[model samples]
Target: MDKIMMWVMAICALIGGVDQLAGNKFGLGRRFEDGFQLLGPTALSMAGLICITPLLSLGLEHTIVPLYRILHLDPGMLGGVLAIDMGGYQLCKELAQDPAIGRYGGIIVGATLGCTITFTIPVGMGMLGEREKPLFAKGILAGLCMHPVGILTGGLMCGVSLGKLLFQSIPVLILAILLVFGISRFPDGMIHGFRIFATVIRSAGTIGIALGAFSYMTGLQLLPGLTPLDEALKVVSSIGIVLLGSLPFAEILQRLLKNPLEWIGEKIGLGRNGTAGLLVGIVSALPVIADMKRMNEREIVMNAALLVCGTSMVAAHLGFVLGVDAPATGALLAGKLTGGIAGVWMAWRIMK
Candidate 1:
């Protein structure tokens, strides 16, 4: 019965996509009923988010671990993460600057917080009394600013502080930044793989690389270990880690900061719950993001906002992986996921 209830919720959440469509419908709704006018960038962003889940699920299990261990210098693995992060951040940042992308800032604001709260806070809760816990949190954030969070966590696990590590990483960070920038400049046509169905194939390629590395280095003798099903979840989880960790959770945060009222409003039951519902609606309304709003521009903005909030789950989940124990990642993930999706839906009803 518990499992059934969860399935029911998931299904209901998925179906919220329809609400988005309905919201956009002519004459009676928010304003932008004709869904056909949705922005290409927004649609592309939606497709990218949806596509990554399945792709990550497909192949990383067999590849990533071995590759990372073997080379002990897996630039490809790190580079892939950086490329995706930089591209998405740069794109969203640019979008935010455009008045066209500015209106739906609320959704983006929600999504960013969702991912951050989900990933980071839960980890924080666990480390409350632990002597080493604070170090871990500081390490993770500092690492994000200085190096890949994973590597930084790995370093912190090795007992190094960011100040001690930053000088050593200057060369690497500069290189990573350049690599990401270069990838971003790829001919828009070449990069359009994110749009094409074949892009899934491309994404899975990274998984294959990562898994192959993991297995070869570990020397795991089990035959079943190489199977696709065996690796699917782990691989997908890691890509998810990268996505949740890398997305513009902070920028979304900046936008939210811009509006202090949300803080006061939350006291009256209009803040967190409202944001969660909006996110729930976003996941449900992917196929028809434009339907969630009456204005075309607003619809596009809403979709971006939703994507940002959706990333909270990743942020919270990462906290767990980073080793913060007390405020467990499990609790944070659940709370944020619930809050993010619920927030969006609530916003829809209340605002309308």
Candidate 2:
């Protein structure tokens, strides 16, 4: 089922890319508006359990578990992830505004936040045990987590009242729609906010896991207030890992994928390589031709075509090597490679 959904998402990306290449506009009345339309649904739906089920566990812990035995607070988990996504978004946005950093901040921040926030839902859901419950509790929990205090702060700056705006049931529904739609229409906007948050919080789960392993290995307890220095060091280490490790990892992938067409040209016959390359380059390069940074739609087809061939070949090669034969793998690889190229292109675009 998971694999099936993955393929579905890939297909949507392919279709969307093709549409952009053909100069077709989505019903949303914007060229880039449909960018996330399909993938967002699959991600959110698959992550539904995570967003809602935690509330069930929280409720059960308070009602059933002995006070002395209650070891965890679910709110902290929800709030923490929300906070991380928020912090990463803010940090990236700030760096993007800097002349020295500019768009470099945006890519690092956006990718980290985007991947984390989207990945969190599924990861959280998987951590749960079977227990079905009412939707009200889930809805309320989802609202709170989705609109953490920091998100509200930013929304307020944009004239959106996170509390009052999201409290009403109708408004909540509207916000849900917007959240999904906004993902597609302005993926970077969503990522911008999430990245800043992720960077800030750095994810408590990640910290907890690290601390647990460290404690086991060094025979040191990880209790709070016991070692402030240790906690601070851990935080610093995580930050360094993200900045030096994660960012560089992405860069390495980009470098590895460079001249993907040339790689395919070497592997496959030239004719097959050329056809595949043309299709991918046309689709993948839309962001460039569309002038996505400032938001323009003209010249997108030609520019996107070039990018698609060059980068989509990377995805195809990735799929080939991974033995990914599903239609979805094709779509995902196509989208992933395109995204990588888009990131590099955006970086170059901003640099110039």
Candidate 3:
């Protein structure tokens, strides 16, 4: 019964795709209405959010190590440099810029030039007077998630300190600023480019989901050494996990958050722009993100967003992998929390 319920939700959610063709409320109805659009970017972006980051990292690791061994170089140290602009991280960053039509980008990079650089930057910047500026909340959410989230988290298990991890992100942080500047130069051609890329990526993802689900249901493992089929299953099922894990719980979480968030708003004079939803969004940032209405929240929303920049589940999950009793998890969580608060405050001051 539990499994049936879960599958039913998965089928509905997966088929729903973002909140366009389906979903109810502002996004509160039956999301599986236009089944035709299911094979579109929304579905792919959803799957890419979880799967693309991990698979990209996984594939790169496999490729780099093999090449390193052949060339007699350092195994782990001699890795790859990847600059990918497709997937949930990138796609969402692009979509959030302008819903009716816009171009947004999320970037993840890990390159070693006598040193290692692991960087992820989310952009919400728009052209001056263009009516579409990337929100700090959207940027923060993108930074903290996607495929690279796994690599940064995995670093913790390998004894990398949070400080060291943050240091590596510095380069990407600089690049991210430039990325925002670059996005402000958008034109008609870019939108077309985005759609074309999105279609290709989504088509690949949707097919992977179908193939992967079939393999799982029938207990078949076609690929022996590599994981072409396994990878497909992993990506699709990951989308299911996100939908199952985040959506249903969001309602309950939102209810619990109302009073506390309202109190904070009153105290801070957060006005109509309060970002309590961003905090509530802690459970599943993407869903809360999808539900955001730019017209309502203004300064306070931006403040809330800038406040929580560069923080996410990836950062905290690393600690758990260190063991519940381990000091690393607790330490990292505390650091990120404190840093997030301070960052938000500073951002408010500077942007003001």
Candidate 4:
């Protein structure tokens, strides 16, 4: 599976690179460029956190571990509070008693649930207009309702038994329920809370980077277990490399699926903007969010739900998994795609 994915990425790179050099008539070149362009932002968001995850894990072990263990859950499940790229994998690996559970928690749970809480809710609310916020919240609530399907599917793919998966997911389920209630009942407050959460994460990432740089330059260990700045950056670089191919491949896939998606949208009563948003959101959610003004209320709500687990699946999330855990790429795809589609279906029923 790893070899096949590598080959696929290599082929994508070849095509993207050639298209870029040959005047980019196909526009795949832009996506190829986007991969590199993402490095700075990605590093800003995650590299620092990665460097300090070992230290964080130690603290978690002392504080959160006992309670989780008492509940018969893996401590690694706590790491799913952060996005996959933002130290979730490192923390999970560090805290896990069971390696399989760690991988399932960090990659599968983190990408969907963690990403939604840390990235999607805050960022999505901040970007949309006031009128759209409530609609977006409704969509997110719907998505949250269906998130377990994705997590369960991904867990099974990671070789976790259904019973074990459910057992370990107790905390996650509780937190998710809280989130749903918060978004549904207190949209404004939840938006504020998510923004503050994102701010705190960014602040922590910045501090981690500063400390890592200081440790590296002075050859003095201020923090005993800090991951080297260089090593953290290397992980970021690997993800970037994978993106070089994933982005262009996503572009190609979008182009091929464009007509079929439109046809499906027509039959399903989705607007043109909704169909376009679904396709674009796979590569990145920013564009779709930016263009929400063109969509009707139903489209806006559906998109918000879809993007909860679906955003960047074909691009950023895929690249991250392929770079970090190549074998889990299939699981990530299955979890995210199915979870996202389910969210859309649920939203349709709710709207009806």
Candidate 5:
């Protein structure tokens, strides 16, 4: 199975790489990018769990066990909130606002806002999924505009509080949708500003992960009696390991899935590389990026829109790692796919 999967990945990478070298939009077909996108998060998270958080979030057991055991909390519903919150934070803050996006604080805001406040799987995935900053902007706007059918469904599965759901979560969710609609009225031209608040934050992604990894290793508390440094550090470590040692496997995995994904995509009537896109997370968009036929600007943007707006294995994994209940987990998976498709179609119409 490993060999077969590896062969698949290699062939996919080769085809995608050839397509890209011949003048494709963004997918360059390097093992480096592919590996970083797929394995980066899991690697960083695992290293952190083993080192920093002291197994507080070691596995499903540690992450959600506390909800049931120590805190005497409902692992199903409230866990959904935490799951959504963590996944959103990871995607929006940690992953968005990259070099691909601008370096300004506003880009961060734009990325976060465009990716949607509550639904943020796109920000991270878009970093690699399309690698085009404008598409990120467009997709973010589209993602934020989506209705919270899946989110509400997930919350319901988790047994969330009725009043809180109706009043707090539902209200904010509606407001966010309104914001997206409002933003849609803005012009489509790209403008630039020269001020960058903190150039350091731009590079801080891998650095943050490294610092967290070091902290995890040495058991050092940079700030005593402060926030949960250990947990924070560990999560950072997990996010940072993309460069450390996760790319090779990520590249292999990307290649293996390409042909099958493309085949599935053709069946579904998604241009050409649709399935490749369905699987395109942050950086491993080689399948879509390398497709020679759909190299136009609109095609590129649409492909990314689909991934961020439609697919979200990353969010699902984060929820699973955090020990969200099965019902909530199902909601996250189903909701992102459904919402993403809706967002993509809407963005297509909104594009002017």
Candidate 6:
């Protein structure tokens, strides 16, 4: 499966590259270019955190590990508090006694639970208008309710035993339930809290980058265990490379799926925007969230629910997984897609 995916990416890269050389007649080249364009923002968001993960892991191991052990859980599960690309993987690896659980936590839980906390809630709330916040909050609450489906599915796909999966998920379920309650009862407070949390993470990432750059330029290391800036950048570059293909491939997929999605939307009583949002949200949630003005209330809520687990499956998340752990790409895909679909259904039922 890994090899097949690699070949698929390579083929997509070739197609994207050729389209670029041919002056982007099909506009596929624009997607190719977008991959490179995203590198700067991606690095700004994550590189520093990656560099400083070892330091953070040390603190977490000392403070949190004992509690997790007492609960018969892996400390790596704590990494699910951060987004996958934002040092979650590194932190999980550093703290895990079990490598499989680390992968499960960092990739599966991180992408779903972690991304929702750090990126989805804060960023999505910030992007939407005041009028839309309530609807969005409700959708997120619905999404949170179904997040376990994705986490458990992904865990199983990652070869984690059912007993361990259930045990390890205790903390995630608790946190998710809290999030659900917070968003449902105190939307404004939850939004404010997440914004503060996101700000702290970004600030820490910037400091990590600065410290790494300083250490690289000078022979002296200010922090004893910081990863080199260059090393972190290398990981970013790898994801960028994968994105070159993934973005173009996503464009191709959107084109191919448009008619069917439209037909499905019509049958399901969803408007054009809602159907379109579902397809687009898979590539990245930002564009869909940004364009929510065109959507009706149903569409807005449904799209939000989908974004919880579905966002970036075909683009950023896929690129990141392929770059870091190619073998887990299938599990990532299955988890996000299935979970996202379930979220959408849950939203529909709630709205009904």
Predictions in order: lDDT: 0.32, 0.31, 0.36, 0.89, 0.39, 0.90
Residues 252-352, candidate 3: write the lDDT tens digits. Answer: 44567677777765655444334554454343233334334443434433433432332232211221112112223333334334434544444444344
Local accuracy of candidate 6 as per-residue lDDT tens digits, 1-352 = 7678777877898899999999999999999999989999999988999989999998987898999888788998889889998888888888888999999999999898889899988988899898777888888888889999988999999999999899988988999999998888888898999999999999999999999999999966899999999999999999999999999999999999999999988877789889999999999888888878788888888899998999999999999999999999999999998889999989888887
The TM-scores of all predictions, comma-separated, are 0.29, 0.24, 0.45, 0.98, 0.46, 0.98
Error of 3 at 341 (Å): 4.0
Worst 10 residues of 2 by lDDT: 131-140
Candidate 1's displacement at residue 341, Å, is 16
lDDT of 1 by residue, 139-232 (tens): 2222123223323333333333556434333434564455334323542332243234234434444454454446556855323333332343
- Cα lDDT of model 5 by residue, 1-352, tens digit: 2234334434544554564566644344453344336444544333332232222223434455464445432222211211222332332222212321111111122222223332333223333333454554565566556545434443344344555444424433655565555444541321111012112222333344565655556777552322233565454444333232223334445567788767754554455444555556533333544452444444455555654434333332322322311223333445455665665665566653
Error of 3 at 198 (Å): 4.8
Which regions of candidate 1 fall more than 4 Å away from where they truly are?
A: 1-160, 163-193, 196-278, 281-352
Scored against the true structure, residue 101 in model 2 reaches a CA lDDT of 23
Segments in model 4 whose C-alpha atoms lie over 4 Å from true places:
none
Model 6 misplaced stretches (Cα beyond 4 Å) = none
Model 3, runs deviating above 4 Å: 1-158, 162-171, 183-200, 207-251, 283-297, 300-343, 350-352
Q: Which one wins on lDDT?
A: 6
lDDT of 4 by residue, 237-348 (tens): 9999999999998999999999999998998888789999999988787898888878888888888888878888989889998888898988888889999999988888
**Which run of 10 residues does model 1 get worst, by summed lDDT?**
100-109
